[model samples]
Target: MNAISIKGLSVSYDRKTVLTNVYMDMEAGKLYGVLGPNGAGKSTLFKAILGLISSNTGQVLINGEPVEEQRKKMVYIPQKGEIDWQFPATVMDVVLMGRYPFKGIFQRLSQEDKNIALQALEDMGIANLRSRQIGELSGGQQQRVFIARALCQQADIFLLDEPFVGVDITTEKKIIEILKQLTDKGKTILVIHHDLSKVKDYFDKVILLNQWLVAYGDTEVTFTEENINRAYRGQLSILHRTTLD
Candidate 1:
């Protein structure tokens, strides 16, 4: 099944093109790594899919419906740097926000919602930190909280941006394990990632972008040296040494 479909997608900023004529059909129950250098429009693609940005000439469909109609079915976890960690919110408070989508306009969260949030925390091995301030936790713990929130929401598609940055090795392993488990249960996940070394080990497929859809398919076939060279272009020498070391 196609979880996401993009056709003739083009995005621009200040009269400059960011993503040009992009088209892709992402399948369900797969983990996809969105890879490209800085300013490659990787984030822009995510924004377009989430309806956070308007495209110059294209459409994004989620589950064969428009983005607005399917917003609740998707969960986006941006980079840690994008968040205000000192927002005076507890772990539980953040996780509970996921349930708001399913509530009536004036409805208050019920015990069932709390139970679901608690279970999400427990599953992430952070039930003990439910009362901790969001800013006080370590980077890894903070990432886990957001994943827990996604679980609480029961979203079918997940869009995560640079999720493994600034995290401990143990936490990275834990996160990949959790993501694989989600895929096993038929969840679709797309991650904007920079680490090329872990591409094969982590994702079932990859989307290589460089202001366009350079290549996309099963990792074994699409993440080859030729495609990577095409995608990275001028930074090949640096990326090859650093990523393939």
Candidate 2:
């Protein structure tokens, strides 16, 4: 079934166009990768779907319902560099914030919520770092902390932006393993990744964007050399050369 449907999505800032007439239908229980050149409005598309930014025209539906209504089912993990490392919070505190959606603004987090956060940390293999300061962790550990936070939310859809940026190879592999496990349980996962080499290995579907929807479908079908050339415009020619060699 289609877990996400984006139709005619267009976004602009002060009358300057960013994304133009984009459309895509993402299926459930699949790992999708959003690939494009820099400034291709990749992050803009995510924000539009999340209603974190206003769109000039179009609508995003999750599970056939308005995106707003499916907030609990969707969780976004932004780039680790975007987060302030100096934010005086512990690893446990950061993960527990995911439970905020389930409570009133004035309500406090319960012991059960804390337990859920701890378990999420354990699931991410960061249980030992629970009491450590967020800023004191390594890049991979920081990434795991945010991912654990998302797991604590128990959302059915995960939107991760540049998750493997500066992490170690082992950490990246671990994260992918966990993501696949989540998909096996019927959760949908979308990742915004820059590396073209890992797309086929990591995602079942690929959404190639270059300020618009260039191509989107099964990885084997849509990630053709033609589509890559069209979306990346000669910038990814090395990928073709490497594949043929």
**C-alpha local distance difference test of each model:** 0.92, 0.88
RMSD values for the candidates in order, in angstroms, are 1.5, 1.6
lDDT of 1 at 98: 88
The 10-residue segment with the lowest total lDDT in model 2: 236-245
Which lDDT tens digits does candidate 1 get at residues 171-245? 888889999999998989999998889998999999999999999999998998888888988686675647763
Once fitted onto the true fold, the runs of candidate 2 whose alpha carbons sit more than 4 angstroms away are 237-240, 243-245
| Runs with alpha carbons beyond 4 Å of true place in candidate 1 | 238-245
TM-score of candidate 2 relative to the true fold: 0.94
Q: Residue pairs in steric clash, candidate 1?
A: none
On a 0 to 100 scale, what is the lDDT of residue 12 in model 2?
89
Best-matching candidate per TM-score: 1
Best by lDDT: 1
What local lDDT score does residue 203 receive in model 1, on the 0 to 100 scale? 97
